[model samples]
Target: MPRIELRTEIKAIKEVVFDLSRSIDLHKISTEHTNETAIAGTTSGLIGMNESVTWRAKHFGIYQNLTSKITEFDRPNYFSDEMVSGAFSEFKHEHHFEDSNDGTLMIDLFDYKSPLGVLGKLADKIFLEKYMTDLLTERNRIVKEYAESDKWKQVLTK
Candidate 1:
């Protein structure tokens, strides 16, 4: 498995950041480049513990569907989602948030294993890791943007 860890500092309340992190709407917006959409299961709002979402998206020029469930969640603190079915053999993402002197500290721990065994490992070493890291970075950037501004209201207030 490959793991990617990221930390983002946002000037916002932990509650707001936590909610924004779980908002499906915000996820769609952040991944617009990949045309990501939640086709079923909590498609539009915050996804909580035991909730699942099936997402369809274009990745590497191909459209793929992935279903993942929130296995663990603690409001305003942390949450972890794991893949139920997807292209990858394994996928687990943990989102953690903490109150900081300036604002909130958001941390992401992404772990994944690709299919095809050896070939997958090679791909991960060659490019998959960087690609996934970039994707997470962009997602966190969007989260930071929303958390720091009133834009979060658009997705969180409803």
Candidate 2:
């Protein structure tokens, strides 16, 4: 398994940052390059505990569908989503938030196992890990952007 961790400090309210992080609408906007869309289940708005969402996206010239459910949640503090069905053998993404002097400290802990045993390890070492890291980083950047600006109202209101 490969684990990727990221910490982002955002100058915004903790509740706002938390909501933006779980916003399906914000997710779609951040991943526009991947053509990601929520195809089923909690397709829009904030995803809560036990809710699942199936996303269809194009990656590496291939289209794939991944379904994940929010397995754990604690408002404005922490949450986790686990892969229900996807290309990965198994995966869990944990989101953590803490109060900071300026605003909030958002952290992401993503742990995943690839399907193809040895080849999967190779993939992670070669590129998959970095790819996933970049993807997560960009998503966090977008969340920070929205939470710190007026853009958040558009997402939270809907």
Runs in model 2 lying further than 4 Å from the true structure: none
TM-score for predicted model 1 compared with the true structure: 0.99
Model 2 compared with the native: what TM-score?
Answer: 0.99
Compared with the true structure, what per-residue lDDT tens digits does model 2 show for residues 1-158?
A: 78999999999999999999999999999999999999999999999999999999998899999999999999999999999999899999999999999999999999999989999999999999999999999999999999999999999997
Candidate 1: residue pairs that collide: none
The regions of model 1 sitting more than 4 angstroms off are: none
User: Would you estimate the TM-scores of all the predictions?
Assistant: 0.99, 0.99
Candidate 1's residue-wise lDDT over 54-120, tens digit each? 9999999999999999999999899999999999999999999999999999999999999999999
Q: Rate the local accuracy (lDDT) of all candidates.
A: 0.96, 0.97
Worst 10 residues of 2 by lDDT: 114-123
